[model samples]
Target: MLLTDDIIESSCRHNMDFDLKKTLEALLLSTAEPILLKDVVKVFARYHQELSEAQEAIKGEEDEDDIAIEIPSLVTQAQIREALEQLTEEAQAQNRAYRVVEGPNGYQMVTAPQFAEFVRLLRGAPRPMKLSPAALETLSIVAYRQPVTRAEMEAIRGVSVDSALHKLIELELVIVTGRAELPGRPIQYGTTDKFLEFTGIKELDELPASDVLSNHQIDEWMRRSEEEPEEISDEDVGLSKEPKPDELALDEKFVEVDWQRENVESDAAPEPESNENTPL
Candidate 1:
């Protein structure tokens, strides 16, 4: 029979079995929000006096135990389980939802996975955003340094880039798939397919090698930078448009310096003291 207000109210008012009344009340209560069998059982024990007598009869003991009766004996633990099962089946039949599953280490009431399509229809789904540049950079670093925290990235980049990281989330370039095992359990960021597209690379291996700038190349760049004056125009700067194969030959002949050794020597050099005692 269809569940209408008059039908439910009439059943409640006339010749109502305590079990049926409790079930009706449970259905009404659950209408306010998602309710579980355990919750309904608690209410039946508290409010239904006839259920208490029925339970005492089922117990088959005449002791004045003074125990607060909850579910009637007719609705034994096994019966309660069965009733809950029936309620769940009925809910399914009516295109309603009922289920229990583990969530974050505890059980929760959730719509059956099959009814997910219905819930999705009622509530519009969330769409992912595009990743931004800084998000991409953060994602790249995190990808290379799996399980790295935000602190590590900030230390390397020498800047606090919280905002950029948030933008990356908006773009879906970076996602917090898991947490680091550190004390605070900080979130770890990682790249998505969009990162590869943005970089125009098939994989992380396709990225340009850091070895492109050798010590000799660094020295050449420094020398060229120092000797070459700020440009005016090609004509005014005395720059030749003609190819200089000979310049390449000269460049090939130059011996490369060990920048590591030079770096130490440069650091060891003493600083010039202020000229406080200089002769007038």
Candidate 2:
């Protein structure tokens, strides 16, 4: 007989625990990519399905050994979050070489930074290449003010982000989210799950909002830009309209004003041996 899988209240208290943390640890170990809380619940659901089948198979039969497994009937995302936190703490307490981290997508187990050298040696991988200062600055703008356009990033960075933005896209840290509903319908860029992974955060909201570039501040900046946009000129972008000295016309008094009638010593013959030999 299956008991009700509802929440129970205890007057005194019941010492209860679930294998969720250990189950999550196993899932994280086997999973190649970060596993979402929903996916984790699906795994448990599948187990319940199998258990139901087993119970049906042994109905009204003389079974000495009955299949008995206990777990929460309904697992919520909060429960999964709590379990992952426990796993993380357990790893820390045991001084484990690996730890569980919640990435943008979900949860994953990664090698600890202290053991990074050993892991790198095991994989024979080189040290990771770092983003250039220009790229970092460009990425910061895109991350904070995501669904932004190239022009918007340039407006914030005060320079063209073509090269830096291209590099970020190549690195899969940024992606084209969609097109803006503006005059040109510029393509909007946003940080990717991989970007969150790089930054060691669960989401964009987890990014530490700095005093200089908080979300509200960025929003205000955007609003002001639409209301009172600054005029950008070629000079602002390191361009000049001044002509070179060669482009200036020479004065006719000092310089000869011969146009297409300059002294032409006749066309070169197919065989100009006389000119080649120097006429006597």
Candidate 3:
């Protein structure tokens, strides 16, 4: 039989002098994480030793059932599990949910993961800043690959990205610190402290909200995009109007004009070698 309140009250009033409620509350609140069975037993030993000393001072004997003595210490695994189940049932009866979650070496109350997104929608606070589609895509690229060169970021996004990057810089979400050592020394970009605060995360590792795409699916999508045929414009397909040649033709002398290209390859073969490479 477990020790009842009558037994505890009689013992404390007659022989024992300890404040059992204070003792129990102290032990329960001390645990930052879930208390294990072994640890519970060890804490029980210490409490029991103290109770025995107090009992001897008043000349009282130890009782058979340990609940009276045990209530002052950390709870055993079985006891905690039973209490949790009972709490869960009581919560369900009232149309509420209760959870015992382990976090950072402690147990804490938390809402179910499935309900998190729904809660977010219910709260519905507007974001601190609004971003254009291009700006959003540019920010994502910088986020995933930080300290990336401007050219590298452009390569991944398949765009010039200059205006978007400039906009982000103006918004103070992205920063350009220094130049890369690569040829021509392109500039490098990375997110700022403002970025983390705006995204509501303390660190970059917390960025992913969910896992949906598998690597195989991503690879297949990329391969299909590369293999797809290019679409021709309406003008190229002969659907739109074409201007009369008379209106589009260049002047005769302008057609003969030769313009110099800055980056033209000098090692290429000359057009006519027959005239000894066409005297300059």
**Model 1 per-residue lDDT tens digits across residues 1-280:** 2333333344355333556534643564455344555655664554455544444553644553642334433334456656555654566677655553222222234566687777777788653245667665666666565455687677555677698877776766667778878899888777765566455454655656544233355446546756858857666768766444566655565567999999999999999998999989
Candidate 2 ranges beyond 4 A from true positions: 1-18, 63-78, 214-280
Worst 10 residues of 1 by lDDT: 100-109
Which scores better on TM-score, 1 or 3? 3
Model 2 lDDT-worst window of ten = 4-13
Cα deviation in Å at residue 128, candidate 2? 1.5
lDDT of 3 by residue, 1-280 (tens): 1334444454465345554334433454565445443554566566556555444443343553443432344346576555544544554566544344433223334444456666667889554478999999888877766667877666666789999999999999999867888999888888886787567554677677423233344346556767858777778878976566566657522244233542364436466548766769
- Residue 109, model 2: lDDT of 91
lDDT of 2 by residue, 4-123 (tens): 222122101221544667767878999678888888878777666655554455556675255333333666778888888999999989989998888778888989889999989999
Which predicted model would earn the best lDDT? 2
- Candidate structures ordered by lDDT, highest first: 2, 3, 1
Question: Candidates 1 and 2: which is better by TM-score?
Answer: 2
TM-score of 1: 0.27
Clashes per candidate, residues 3 or more apart or on different chains: 5, 0, 2
Models, CA RMSD each: 19.5, 14.9, 15.3
Q: What does the lDDT come to for candidate 3?
A: 0.60
